[model samples]
Target: MSAGRVAVAALFVVALVLFAAVEIASRREGSRVPSLGDVCGVVMRYRVGPLPVGRIAMFGFWWWLGWHFLAR
Candidate 1:
């Protein structure tokens, strides 16, 4: 796969692993962490592109930050 496809696959895997770990941990330990569905919903909403330049730039930054901080 190309770099972009690899990156996207990695992101999908990471999100699934994180969601599973957090969900199990929260249930077993009685913590207050958010559910996987809710978190994924929020993330999907934020991933949508925009109609304006500034909005697109901001969304680009948001996308950058997610990969920068979350991806290994």
Candidate 2:
């Protein structure tokens, strides 16, 4: 496979593993993942003031930009 495809596949696997780890940690801690309300609250707060939404939007935006520029 080409380098770019390989990189994407590896990143995909890494993301899956990270997500699984988050889920496991959440279960062990007896704390649930962020709810829609939480995310909405974050967005609302962000609009009112600058706050780290945990880089969620930035990650998605950069991922989109990368795919737009790099993926054929």
| Best by the lDDT measure | 1
Q: Output the lDDT of residue 60, model 2.
A: 79
Q: Which residue pairs show backbone clashes in model 1?
A: none
Worst 10 residues of 1 by lDDT: 46-55
TM-scores vs. true structure, each candidate: 0.42, 0.43
Candidate 1: C-alpha RMSD to true structure equals: 9.7
Q: Name the regions of candidate 1 deviating beyond 4 angstroms.
A: 34-72
What does candidate 1's lDDT look like per residue over 37-59, in tens digits? Answer: 66655655563355455456667
Residue-wise lDDT of candidate 2 within 1-72, one digit each (tens)? 899999998998999898777666656555767644565567545542475654666567779989997997
- Give me the displacement of residue 61 in model 2, in angstroms: 13
